[model samples]
Target chain A: MQKRISIFIFLLVHIASINAQEAKMASIKEGSFVPLYGASSKKPTVVKSFFLDVYPVTNEDFLNFIKKNPSYSKSKIKGIFADKSYLAYWKNNFDFGSANPKSPVTSVSWFAAKKYCECQGKRLPTMEEWEYAAMADEKRIDARTKTEFNTYILSWYEKSKTYENTIGSTFKNYWGVYDLHGLVWEWTSDFNSIFLSGESRKDKNNDKNLFCGSASVNATDLMDYAAFMRYAFRGSLKANYSTRNLGFRCASTTKY
Target chain B: MKKITLAILIILSMQSCKDNTQNKNVTKEKPISDLSIYNLPSQWTNQDGKNIELKSLKGNVLVMVMIYTSCKAACPRLVADMRSIESKLKPETKKNIKLILVSIDPETDTPQRLKSFAIENKMNQEPWIFLRSTEENTREFAAVLAVNYKKITPIDFSHSNIISVFNPEGELIYQQEGLGVNNDETVNKINQEAEKIR
Candidate 1:
């Protein structure tokens, strides 16, 4: 009888251990605001309430993911979903050498980041949600007009190798989210939706005829050069492209 | 002893099922090239409501664009661009090509809608394929094609105007950007690829 009782306890513990640990998330109340893009013209866009991770995804978290989904490991991942440098920094499939485990995992492609979120039953935040949450300073929800807020972000852009820093190492925002500005650039679900200046000759013709309805889209706030940098960075990304300073976090719609 | 053996067999069968599903295409075909789009595993539905995988179109040269049936602006010219490309191709090479238009708005563009659009555009004949899948797969496919798109209103979307060509092995070979640009280069590339299959 004692042996039988012990066996039951062991089975319960084993089953619990099999499940992946859930990441902590903060609740963001739904609100409306006009971001630089995504709104109809320059009108306000309504962002429904969602939950977002407090910090960017860390190297340790991704390591746990690849353990369960071996197909996504650096050596085995399909070429269509990621480029040759998907996890160039990782020393091996299960090991991340010389890099801090708590630092945000960079050099991950959009497809790889999307898969990571899905495995956790979460998804990458839409661009509106990301921009909405990011606009906040430590005190105010919308700080685009604040000179200090814009300056701080621009300074971080000038900083080198901030991706090597640990997550949650920067100031917490009004939404209780951390490292939104000072860490690394993140991938959004709709990152490809952006259309910047018709810089290229191909795009010059495309803007007139190829993208017929895009005449309505223009920079809503040219003074907010920090936001413009983010939009331009998103515009340049292809799904399979990965860089050393690019990472992402997960978000989910909140249910009452 | 008998019960334990039976339990083990059940567990083994479940493992086999998982493996078969994951390796479904990899095992049947020669190893897919690292750069081939056929490596994608997402399932899609064609205009006829038949479910198919991208791998099924492996043997033909592919000319693909992303557009919705409801677009008021760029999609029409994009479609016209595709049609003009097809008209310019040599009659012999046309037999070995498939011009696919994947819908960015899957919610509104059903298989029936796609089929009707095909008929309305006089593209109901051979070598014209219309495909729509779940929204997630659509975004992923757009990413692969470097096609940017966004829904602006209930019935309209703004998207990049680019047409891509793929060789018979599902590797991207050439891309023609912008609207109504010269098709001579695109046509030459298509002819060259088709020549290889002949």
Candidate 2:
């Protein structure tokens, strides 16, 4: 009788893991758009068809992740991979505490988030893929130009402690993805590609000495100040650093 | 017989639960500092096509820079800067230091290409190593170095000009940012770090 129960438990755990590995995701179609940074202003970067998580990764999902990958657990994590504040809100390695189980996980470093996605057999979205999917509002594919669209994002930026909110509380975009803007900032696979800030200065406006090809890749639309803020935020980040208002979701080239 | 099978099954499931973390954290040496680059688990191939991990290079002070062999704009000057730093080092310090050029454009800068570039640049000798890895690993490595780069065209990349110095323990000690900047501070730091290594 004990042998039968053990076999049943094994099968149950295996199925549960398999389901976690394949979470809810939205299929994003391929298209082209000029981003606020990283390409020549006149040129549009093409995004291949991909899958994105419908919502940001929640504290519940991440707890499952750390249970399996304990090297990333709070105590065992190498200092090179994450900063001191990583998962600071969680009570311990196994529990996220009184924070809502369904709330989006925050204070995760780029390395931890990257590993979480890789273990899922997926990868983090490129900055371009992220910006492309995020360009949509509830009704339109390209809504950056709309006053209401920009206002909503800008207001979310003004709002304090939105990271405490649950995922999918925000409106779904054109691609059926949620919380691209209203939730915490996310880590991109190539967030380091952006070049702005201290590198640019007087007479250094096109500082070829500090960075290569900076002259040609100015912001395509200065009016999209909202996107510019995201680019600047990415520029300021180091991979090992984590914060209370930062979180991430996985993306994949193939549908699961 | 059923009892034996179930025991094996329980053991197997426990091992599987530990599988993900086991593949990483390959090195458990107590002395390796938490901030050391040796903690990175990625594998890399050198100009000679030998597989290496950052931990294997632990005993030498590392003077590392990221560049693509194909870069025409800043890498040539960066290469000159690296050579200049090497030239100024004392023979004793040279014994303890390795000047490394890591490739950001791994897709095009194959081991063969790196070998030829090393030969052409007259860097195919002691203390100069060229390394490349998978694109994902390269990105992760770049993140560690805080070196930012992007491909502007099919054949060209835009990258920052930075040379990072790490102590023998694989902890980053100093960084020289910008092209053709003063190397006095960098060389002194390298000498100072190398002196401690011996």
Candidate 3:
């Protein structure tokens, strides 16, 4: 009888773990919208229906990742993949220090975030797809026109130490995804594609000397100040750069 | 018997999960510095239809630019800039440098296409290499170089015209930006890095 009980317990634990290993992903339906900048000025970039992580990749999740791939750990990571501050907030190479393990992992470079997604059979969201999903509020799909939506994002910009909060702490949006705002700035796969030079002089006029095809890419909505800030921030980022407030989540083409 | 089967099944699944993150591609080598581009593991096919890793050019100063074969604008000027930089270098210094043109449109710029472009442009010689890789790897490479590019149409891509110079250690030493721009400074930087190779 004890032998049978032990077998049952093992089976139960195994099944439970299998379920836990599978991260939850929210299904975002196919949609089309004109981004502030995209493939073109007039044509709306069409985003296919895909599964996005319901929450940002957490410290607990990243710890598990480093356990499997030690090369990505703080000490072991290559300088080509990240800068000196990669995981600087962590107490040690393996420990998250005073950080909440349930909180989204920050101070991760685009390369590190990208590898994390790829290891899980997923990929980082493109800027178009990320903006498409993030434009939503609690009810509407395209919420940039909503005054409150813009205000909420702008207010979060003013808030400090928001990265300390755990994933899913913020209000879930229309697609049931949380922490797109009021948590941390996330890395997109093609963050380097932005043309707006971060230097005040270059930002004043779209400098032709700095960009090869700057004229081809333009802002469809100059009024979206919140998104403009996001674009400018992305424009300034190099893939190897890691910072305290920046984090990322994974997205998959296939539904899980 | 069922108990044994269950245990084996559990072990197999766990093993596969571990397999996902195993260092399958990395091989034993002299410990690469964190800042070296040699740490990148992407593969490429050269103009000669040869599969090569970036590490193969490890000890040579790399002067690299991105271009597409079909491009009518900027690429010619960029190629001219590379050639001019090459001409300005002392023959001794030139021998230690590899002028590489990486194709942004890998689909159209196959090894054969690159070879023809090399021959037509009179660069099909020693110290001049043309390479193309998978679209994903190319994008990652561009990100490392901080070169912004986007496919504007089916045939055209708008890419930054920046020539990056890497030392024999695969560490970026200098960058010359803009098309048809004076490359005197860039040439001097390249010579300075190449001089260290001896």
The regions of model 1 sitting more than 4 angstroms off are: A1-19, A199-206, A254-256, B1-25
lDDT: which candidate is best? Answer: 2
Query: Per-residue CA lDDT of candidate 1, range A1-256, in tens?
Result: 6765675576566446434446778788899888887566787888899999999999999998888777778998778778999899999999999999999999999988998887666889999999999999999999999999999999999999999999999999999999999999999998999877654325646466656567877778889899999998998889998999999999998531
- Cα error of candidate 1 at position A51, Å: 1.3
How would you encode candidate 1's per-residue C-alpha lDDT over B65-183 as one tens digit per residue?
99999887778889999999998888877889999999999999999999999999999878899999999889989888888888877788878888999998899999998888899
Model with the higher lDDT, candidate 1 or 3: 1
lDDT of 3 by residue, A165-230 (tens): 989999899999999999999999888777775533223324465566667778888889999999
* Candidate 2 C-alpha lDDT tens digits along A1-256: 7877887798778667657567789999989988888775468899999999999999988988887788898888888899999999999889888998888899999999998887777889999999999999988879989999999999999999999898889999999999999989999999989888564322233367778766666788899989988998888889998999999999999986
Give the Å shift of residue A13 in candidate 2.
3.0
Q: Could you give the interface RMSD of each candidate, to one decimal?
A: 5.1, 4.3, 5.3
**Recovered fraction of real interface contacts per model:** 0.62, 0.64, 0.45
The residue-level lDDT of candidate 3 at B104 comes to 93
TM-score per prediction, in order, is 0.90, 0.91, 0.88
Best by TM-score: 2
Give the clashing pairs for model 2: none
Between candidates 1 and 2, name the one with more favorable lDDT. Answer: 2
CAPRI band for model 2: medium
